[model samples]
Target: MAVTFYINLAYLLGAIAFVWGLRLLSTPDTARRGNILASIGMGLAIIAAMLAPLENTSNNYGWILGGMAVGAGIGWVSARRIQMTAMPQMVSMFNGLGGACAVVLALVEVFQFYGGERTLDSGQLVIVLSTLLIGGVAFTGSLLAFGKLQGLVRDNTLTLPKHNIINQIMLLVLIVMGVMLVIQGQEAGLTMAMIFTVLALIYGFSFVIPIGGADMPVVISLLNSFTGLSAAAAGLIYENNFMLVGGILVGASGTILTVLMCEAMNRSLLNVLIGGFGGGGGSAKGADGDQVAKEVSINDAAIQLYYSNSVMFVPGYGLAVAQAQKVCKEVDDLLEANGVDVKYAIHPVAGRMPGHMNVLLAEADVPYPKLLDLDDANSALPNTDMVVIVGANDVVNPAAYDDPGSPIYGMPVLNVWEAKNVIVLKRSMSTGYAGIQNPLFFHAKNRMLFGDAKDSLNKLVQELKNL
Candidate 1:
């Protein structure tokens, strides 16, 4: 009784830590502390769980410790080595592993019941089966997303003939199998569970493959929510309060983030799932068809920056691709030293994931207060003296406002064109992930600075120092 009481107490404390940690994660200032708190809470929960009574008489701790050591080593090494460019793929892989863990636990519970070593009520059985289904889908779906992001699988939408019909059929089959499993119970349900798992895995892969690269952030958010819900189901099966609370927090937060991302892109969740936004890289030719982009030399660009009183830096995936966040910060620091006010404009959907730009900039030691969101940055742009667009394209495109027939017509973009002078640094005039050209390049206020983002920023830093 004392052991049970202590275990419950630990779980309650862990739940509180998780809640506080999640609350702190809402703001950039406390995000690192929040992560540490959450890690500590998870550690406490794991320790408490290990101390609880086990069903079997196997007292061997070697296997468990060995597994923990291996997992910890791999995670440490991976986190240390992964670049910001591959962070989205890494997130996908981690979320998938969480789902896979839930699936494995569910399967183990079902097998134990089948072997007569344990007995579960109908409610428990249902929870276990549900966890299996949701976790299976999340696991396979996340792996496919990781593959797409890694360039191992094609990033473009992969659709079969009558894809919608096939998807519906598969879903129906899964539903039927789930019903059979529940009805059959302990006697004949094992086979049905296996069949359901297979169908769920296939459905997960099929669901994610049709999504294009532009929609990956939303997909990642949605899959994260799925994994959380699966974990919650696992918690219910085990009657673990800590896991239940943690899962609920993750599910709620992930769902909110996913909705925000969809809103940021001015897209509906259903439309994103149906998949067709980003096709091939096709440049839009509107009234700017005859307008030629004027290229500016690094020295000339530096002169503009040096004279400007206020500058806003807009970052995108190109910044990540060039691994230029550090040098970008160097430019900011140099400009600040010259008494220039510099700020970073962060679009909600910038880069491949939510908070991608924030994370990169944070690593470069950019001040949290200096990072402005879409609306805030837009408000500041009109009065700003200069806008330095570093490897950004579609986010600052004037076409989002001017072209009614464009694919990203209603999406909210940074109003960089509203600034007095705009200098865009890029290797070429290629379209962004949305595969659409940005007319902002041809705008009168904008000048193209064609080069690698890191090189251009380095040159800018050198010029600023010379000044």
Candidate 2:
């Protein structure tokens, strides 16, 4: 009785922390502190779970503690050493591991229940089967996402014929197998569980392999929700309140993020799941008629910036690829020092993932107040004197605005073209992740400053200082 009280208190505190931490995470100012608070909450919940007394559950402290320690050490090292460019890959991998944990927990529950006195009730069957399936899909699916982001898997979308039909059939078969397993109960339980797990794993792989690289972030977020749902199911099996609450919180938040991102891209969740955007070889054409892009020298670009009253910097995946965020911030600081009004316009889905650019910029000590979201940025763009696009393509593409027939037609984009002057820093006239050619290059007032983003920014900075 006394032991149970301590467990309850820990779980209650942990749940409160998680909620408060998530609330704090809504803004940039306290996001780090929120993250730390949430981490502490999770730790408390874990320790409480370890101490709780549960029926038909193994308390292998040595094994559990050893696994926890190893995972912690590895995660700590990875966090310390991993670069910002690899953030998406790391996030995908971590989400995948969460799924794998749910899978293992489900397996342990089923395996130990063999020859037990009570048969699995309908509730247990639902919880256990759902956990296994969801967890299995999340594990391998996330790994595939990580592999694509890491360049181990091919970047392009690979689909077999009738892909949708094939998945439908597989899901049907899994359902039938699950129903049969539930009916057979303890008699054929062990064998069927293994078979079901294997099928789930295969489905998970097939599920993600056809998705294009550009859709990977959404896929990762969706898979994170899957992992959370699986964890919640695992909690039901273990009868742990902390586990249930934590899992529910994660699942709900991930689902919300995924939905918002899909809306931001002006695509349905179904369209996102069907994949085949981003990494495909295609570009959208629009109203901007000038095919010959105008080029501006570094000195000329610097002159434009120097004379401008206000400037907005737009960063994207190219900036990330060039590792130019720090240099980009340097340019911002230089302009601000020169009595120029400067702010950064960030798209909701800027770099490969949500908040990717924000993290990079924050690492350079960019002020939080200077960052603006889509609506606010768009409203400010028209009054802005100049817009310096740093390796951004799709998000600022006029194609999204003027071309109704374009793939990204309804997607929200930074209206940088509305600014008095537009200077694009790019290596070439290459298309972006959506595989869409930007019409912004040909806009009458636009000048393409073609070069490596970091090097170009360095030259522009030098030219400004000279002036």
Candidate 3:
């Protein structure tokens, strides 16, 4: 009785820690601390489980400890070594692993029940099947997403003729199989369950393959939610309170993030899922036919920045691709030193993932307060003396506002053109991920500084120092 009491007490404490940690994760400043607290909570839960009064749990401690050590070592190494650019893919992979774990747990439980004299109740069977189905989908879906983001798989939508019809048929079959398994009960359901799992895995791959690259942020979040719900189902099967609570929190958070991402792009969840939003690399002609963008030299750009009282920086995936966050920060520092009030204008869907630019800038030690969201940045742009666009294209395009027929018509974008003088540093006049030409380049206030982002920033820094 005493051991049981202590174990329950430990679980309660761990639950509190998880709640507190999740609350803290709401803000960027406390995100690291929140992650640590969550890790500690998980550790406490693991310890309590190992120390439970269940039969042979103590004897299995060696196996548990060995597994923990191996997992910790790999996680530590991966966390330290993975670059920020690949962070989204890493997140997808980890989420997939979580789902895979849930699937494995469900399978183990099924095997144990079948091999032994024990029989699973209808409720237990439902939970097991739920976990298996959801986990299977999340595992394969996330892997496909990771492959797309990593460039290992084609980022465009992959569809066969009448793919929608095929998908509908598969979904209906899966539902029918699940219903049949539930009706058949313990004696005759194992085969159905196995078939259900295979079908779920195929559905996952098919579900995500049709989504285009631009919709990945939303897809990733949705898959994360699926994984969390799967974990919750597994927890219900085992009656583990800690897993239940953790899964609920993750599910709720991921759902909210998915909604926010969809809103950022001014897209509906269904539209993203139906695919074909972001694909093709060909550029659209300018509204007034093809026009050459005016160019500016590094010295001239530096002179504009040096003279401006206030400057705003608009960064995009190009900055991340060039690994120029550090150099961008250096430029901010140099501008600040010369008495220019500097700030960053960040779009909600600026980069490939949510908070991608913010994470990169944070790693370069950029102050959190300097980062302004879309609305705030737009408000600041008109009053700013100069806007330095670093490897950004689609986010600053005036077409979002001016062109009613454009694909991204309703999407919010940085109002860099509102500033008095805009210097855009990019390698070329290529369209961004959306594959649309940016009319902002031809705007009277804008001057193109064509080059690699890092090199251009370095040159600007040298010019500033010389001045």
Candidate 4:
């Protein structure tokens, strides 16, 4: 009885830590501390579980410790060594591993029930099967997301003809099979469960495949929710309270973020799940229209920035690729010293994942208050004298609002063109992830200063100093 009491106490404490940590993570100031607290909470839960006595359980310290050491070492190394550019892929892969863990746990319960070593009621069977289904989807779906971001999977290979219809059929069949497993209870054999797991995985790959690169931010978050839900299901099967609470928190947060991002894109949840939307269909007479984009030299752009009453810097995936966050920050600092008001306009889907640009800027020690979200930046744009688009593409595209026939039409984009003078820094006239050309480049008020973003930024800084 005392052992049970102690276990419950530890679980309660862990649950509290998780809640507090999550709350802290909502803001920039305390995110690091929150992460540490959550890690500690997880550690406490693992220790309590290890000490808890259970039937037919031989706690092999060597194997368990060895596994823990290896996993921890890999996680630490990967987290430390990974560049901000590849963060989305890393996140996708790690989230998949979490799902894989839930899969293993569910498989153990499934095998035991099928072998007659254990039995469960209909409700319990449903929970076990649910864990398997969601976990399988998360595992393979995340891998596909990772592959897409890493360029290992080509866009042409992502979808089959009429893939949407195929995905719908698979989903319906998976649901029917899950219901059968629940109804059969102990009567269901291992073969049925294995078939269900395989189908779920296939559905997962198909589900993510149709989504375009532009929608990756939302897709990754949704996959995270799937992994959390599977973990919660596993916890329910084992009656572990801390696991349940932590899983619920992760699942709920991930879901909320996904919905919020969809709203930001002015898209419905159904549209996102439907999946054919983001594959950019090249639009004619939009950004690809015959208007010639004007050019600006580094010296000229620097003079414009130096004398501007107010400036807003817009960044995109290009900024991340050039590893120019520090240089970007340095440029902003120089402007600030000259009494030039500077702020950064960050689009919700600026990079490969949500908060990607924010994380990169944060790494360069950029001040939190200087960052302006979509709404705030839009409202402030008209009064701004100069808008510098650094390594940006679709987010600042005028076609989002101008051309209804465009693929990203009606999508909420940064209104950088609303400023008096617009300067775009890019290596070339290439289109963005949405696979659509940007009309903002051809806007009468905008001028393109073509070159490597880092080189241009450095040269601009030199010119600013000379002036």
The lDDT leader among the candidates is: 4
* Candidate 2: residue 98 lDDT (0-100): 92
lDDT over C-alpha atoms for residue 218 of model 4:
94
lDDT for each residue of candidate 3 in 1-467, tens digit (9 for 90 to 100): 88888888888888899999999987679989998998899888888877775766347767778988998999899999998778889989998999899999988977776666567887787888889888998999999989988988875546766665777898899888777777777666566667888898888888888787777778888999999899889879878888898888888888999999889778889878874556655343364575778999988999999989999999888888889999989989999998999999988777777778888898999999999999999999999999988877777877777687677777788888788999988898777777788888888888999999999999988999999
Query: Candidate 3: lDDT of 279?
Result: 69
For model 3 the TM-score comes to 0.95
> Each candidate's lDDT (Cα)?
0.86, 0.86, 0.84, 0.88
Tens-digit lDDT track for model 1 on 1-467? 88889989889888988999988888878998998998888888988888887555785677888999999999999999999999999999999999899999998997888777888877887898889878888899999989888878875546787776787898888877766667777776566667777788888888887778778889899999999999999999988888888888888888999999999988899888875566655456553447789889988988889888999999999999999999999989888988999999999988888899999999899999999999999999999999988877778877788788777788899999889999999898878887888888888888899989998899888988898
Stretch of 10 with least lDDT, candidate 4: 281-290
List candidate 3 stretches off by more than 4 Å.
57-59, 281-288
- Relative to the unseen true structure, what is the Cα RMSD of model 4? 1.4
Tens digit of lDDT per residue, candidate 2, span 236-309?
A: 98888888988898899889989988888899988887756776566577534647889999888898898889
Instruction: Kindly report which residue pairs in candidate 3 clash with one another.
Output: none
Q: Candidate 4, which segments miss by more than 4 Å at Cα?
A: 54-57
- How far out, in Å, is residue 356 in model 4? 0.6
Q: Candidate 2: where are CA atoms >4 Å away?
A: 54-59, 115-118, 155-157, 286-290
Ranking by lDDT: 4, 1, 2, 3
Predicted structure 1: lDDT:
0.86
